[model samples]
Target chain A: MEVKKSFEEINEKIKNGTAVVVTAEEIIDIVKEKGLDEATSHVDVVTTATFSPMCSSGAFLNFGHADPPIRMTKVLLNNVPAHAGLAAVDAYIGATETSFDRDIEYGGAHVICDLIAGKKIHLQATSPGTDCYPRKKIDTYITKDSINEAYLFNPRNCYQNYDAAINTSGRTLYTYMGVLQPNMANINYSTSGELSPLLNDPYLRTIGMGTKIFLAGAPGYVAWQGTQFITEVERGNNGVPTTSAATLAVIGDLKQMSCDYIQPAVFEKYGTSMFVGIGIPIPVLDKDMLMNLAVENKDIYTNIVDYSVGRRSKPSLGKVNYAQLRSGMVTLEGKQIPTTPLSSLSKARAIAQELKRWILTDKFTLQEPFKHFNKVSKLNTLEEVGKGEIDNE
Target chain B: MSKKAYKQRIYIEAEKCVECGACTAVCGAKALRLDKTTWKLIYNVQKCQGCMLCVSACPSRAIKSDIEDLPSAVAAAL
Candidate 1:
């Protein structure tokens, strides 16, 4: 019997600047164990965003951290199952376990397109009424004649048309939005308009899942306005230091977009099939919105929290806050890679039978006779040459 | 036959309880417990619902709630 958070209701919602949401089963158990397909595959990318039958048999994927980034990564890879390799998983679940009822407004992109098109579709967006608006033509196009005219002019099409498309897209429609500080230090942002290189470019390079992703119950807010184009690179400095001009345009754009991690040839080109992990879903921060953003922007810095997870980003081993988040199983380690395991229920039937045998294996050919793990072989190429089949080979 | 009488008040605070288990991993009213031998933070106060998130995560502020201590703990639950 315990519960609290009252310093005058956390200083009147951070002195009325408002913006804190997170719920939907705390963003589907932190994207079923922190997202980006659990950081480049190993199953458990599952998401319905919130309550459903979801406890495995997963494949929901909805996410809309305030849409319009190539239509939110093409409606999260066109509602799953493209090329069927799997790993759609991103239906908006970055932070929540408390602090909701932000006046119960709704329609985070039509409740993520009616929870990935299970219904409704009155889709409308023409926006251009000034300040940073770029959703020109979508006056009604989630096809099939707008979901049969949005279920024949509303046969109780609930979630209230995502609150009428967030009141005609004035845009503060967030339901479980993420990253409360994610600027793993490579900041640079000077441009003015037309944004969305994945949400107003802070030097985009955010590939997803399984590298620890969880942030429960509000509190995560790290949008540090591109940490004022970072400069501080003095610890180790293996390279990239031609006497600052923003570290020579951030080390000539991280040596033409290489963003670290290629050593041992990317673990000898996927030996052990390249597995990385990160699972963070620790949000319980409306301590009066971090004490009114640390008393009005603690000298206005804003790197928007990236608190490093693994594989040497300034070589970390801290910052996994919310009083050290917990609640049944979560592991991640590096170098010799021992810790792994992030999704549970006893490692989900041996990681879904090793991702269904690494999707019907092809084990880089050794020219015949190698079919081990329970049979699979039918390789042919003779061109019907009756007589000496392999003689002309 | 229903009357408006459902007061609130359910709290805990065994010295800023650090037996982490995140308020019993989000207790929808499993009625909080983390006493694996004197970790000290058990409860059954009629399966509480004043949900203050263990008093906004008591890093040692300890928990609190007292809506007149819920009609004498619901009159010792009937």
Candidate 2:
């Protein structure tokens, strides 16, 4: 199919409220009925979304300066420990970090959620007296309003594809994948089926550095390639990985975020995490991009792995498509195994629909990626360094 | 049926509470409050009316209740 509009022209159409925007959920049915050419010509943007519990997420907050401006060496937010190793007033609170009071019910993710919910959190910090900054201790209550800057600068957020976890052993397993029933009785998957952001842009064509995205509830950008991005994974005919592959590091202003999009989640056994709602708008640059966006649940595949193993490389039972997974049942060894998703499909749809409304109303505009992601980056496995071996590569 | 026909009470597990204040928001009886210092949910059984609204509103399944069977002597005495 010959392309008629450039990215700039599409932006012009978006500004004028003339661009045809549909969500990834809507485009599947559109493509099925109208074919790729007709769908590509009709749709100017495809909004993709996913609401999942991302454990490797955190927020960096600059609480401004205290009265005496203490160089905070140790920090705690609502009993949850935050990394105060940065500047005097800045700290980073990871999602999975538990409180110093050893409360499993609350964690860093809960603190971030409480702040977003417009609730005040107790902020306590300690520092030795310094020459320039003489304050030694600070104990106060802080809300989102009290902090000068509170932004989520997650090192990793969206995964291209992930594995469905099941336990084969006689005992149950408490993992980041959620609680898995023993003897492969139940499986837990964590993707939003077809509406996932990375799955929509399998090859990372429109999603890259400086790409504007709906993060949590605020407008954010792709900061960089996500940590532990395995780009060398096996791909299907459409260049979409069948297993774990690409990821995106994103950053967004926490002050602009809403509690509706970002929620604190506590797994029954896996502790605390954040259910981050992310939406990315893919500008239909060409027919190939349209086809990628048209990719459905049956086209995307992931492996069901046994999480009972204690090693990094677990045994994979077999491959399963998102369609089968989303059906809430998949056959494993001729037996029907019920499936549960850790991600919320309802929340994902809400985000996609919300983003679609934003684009349709000209409230949110599409952004051209400053640079496309590198395809040749290799993921290295972790290895223990031998003593007295100064290996320099 | 009278109000005393069924024995009811609200069970609040403070250990399971994340202090998100969702239960407090849904509690019409104002039985639940967050301790500002400890950031924990404080439940007053006297103020609770066994509405069970907080039980369903709790995201963490922290709140539960049991309906105790009253003895005939106790019911008659009351």
TM-score (chain B) for candidate 1 is: 0.25
User: Each model's C-alpha lDDT?
Assistant: 0.22, 0.80
CA deviation > 4 Å runs, candidate 1: A1-110, A113-115, A127-393, B1-46, B49-78
Q: Write the per-residue lDDT of candidate 2 for residues A1-393, one digit (tens) a residue.
A: 486567788888888889898899899999999888888888899999988878889999998887778999999999999999999999999988998675656898889988887899999999997988899999999999988989998888888989999899999676777666678877778887688998988888888899989999999999998988877788888778988888889999998898788877666556777778899999998899998998888988899999999997999999999889766579999989877666667677888998888888845887777888777556767788887765667
The alpha-carbon deviation from the true structure for residue A300 of candidate 2, after best TM-score superposition, in angstroms, is 1.1
* Candidate 1 lDDT, A11-99, residue by residue in tens: 35334533132321223344345542331222211111110001101112322213442132222122221111222213221110111
Minimal lDDT window, size 10, model 1 chain B: B13-22
For each candidate, what's the DockQ?
0.02, 0.05
Across all candidates, the chain A TM-score values are: 0.19, 0.97
- The CAPRI category of model 2 is incorrect
